[model samples]
Target: MGTVGITGDDGEFHLISMWVAPEARGTGVADLLLHAVLEHAGVGGGRIRLEVTEGNIAAERLYLRHGFRRTGVCGTVGGDRPEFEMVLDL
Candidate 1:
C-alpha cells in the first residue's frame, strides 16, 4: 500500500501520490480509492490533480476514464522519470 495527499493551495485541493498495493492490483482498488478522493474533493468544493509517469499507460487510461484530463507534462521533482499532470474538475 501507498499514500494519497490532497493539499490546499489558495483554496484549491490537489490530489497526489495515489498508489495501490501490489496484491490489490486489478481488483478495482485504484478506482475505488480515486473515486473516494474525488468525492472528498467535491465535498470541499475543490478540484483534484495528480501526476503519473509518462510510461504508465494503464494509469493514464484509468484517469481518463475517471474524467481526469491531461493538463501538461512535468519533470519529476527528484528523479529522472517524466510525468504527466492530470486534473479532475470536482
Candidate 2:
C-alpha cells in the first residue's frame, strides 16, 4: 500500500510506491495492486509511470508484462542507486 498520484508536470499519474509482505510475495498481490492503480479513476487508458531499481528484475518484469515499456533512466545516473522509468498507456 502507498500514495498514488500524478506528479508529472504533464499530469500523468505515477506509481509512487508499492510493497508486498514477505508472505505475499509470489502470490500475485503485486499484480493486483498494480492493476488497481492503473485502472483507477482517470488512469485507465491513460498514461502512467513508475520506476524500478536497476537490479530488481521481478518488478521490472511485472511492469513490462502489464504493457509498460521502458521510457528512460530515472533518478541520479551513475550512482550506486539507479532506477529505470517505465510507462504504460492503457
Candidate 3:
C-alpha cells in the first residue's frame, strides 16, 4: 500500500509511504504501484520527492531505479537513524 501526499506550497508531490506486504514482495506488486504513482506525477508536472530510511539499500535501489537522484539532504528522521531525500523531476 502507499499514499501520495498533496502538493505542498512549493508544488512538490511527496510520495509519503509505499510498501508491499511481505507475502506480496517481489511479485511485481510494488512495481505496478510505483508505476502508477510516477505516471501520475509525470503527467501532472513539477517534481516528485520521497524519503527513505537509512540503511534501506533495497528501498534506495528501488527509488534510484525509478530515476530519483539522491540529494545532499540527509538528516536524522524521528530522532533516529538518518534518512535521505530523493527527487525525480517530472
Determine the C-alpha RMSD for candidate 1 after optimal superposition of all C-alphas.
Answer: 2.0
Q: Write the per-residue lDDT of candidate 1 for residues 1-90, one digit (tens) a residue.
A: 545667775437777677788887888888888777777778756577788887899899889999999887676855787887998876
Superposed by TM-score, candidate 2 places the C-alpha of residue 81 at a distance from the truth, in angstroms, of 0.3
lDDT of 3 by residue, 15-59 (tens): 888878777777777777778887766765788888889999888
Q: What TM-score would every model get versus the actual structure? A: 0.82, 0.78, 0.84
Candidate-wise lDDT, in order: 0.78, 0.74, 0.78
| lDDT, candidate 2, 1-90, per-residue tens | 332344443446778778888777898888888777766724435688888888899989888888889987578455768878998876
Scored by lDDT, model 1 comes in at 0.78
lDDT of 3: 0.78
Q: Which stretches of candidate 1 lie over 4 Å from their true place?
A: 1-3, 9-11
Clashes of 1: 0
Query: lDDT, candidate 2, residue 54?
Result: 85
Task: Please tell me which predicted candidate would have the highest TM-score against the true structure.
Answer: 3
Worst 10 residues of 3 by lDDT: 1-10
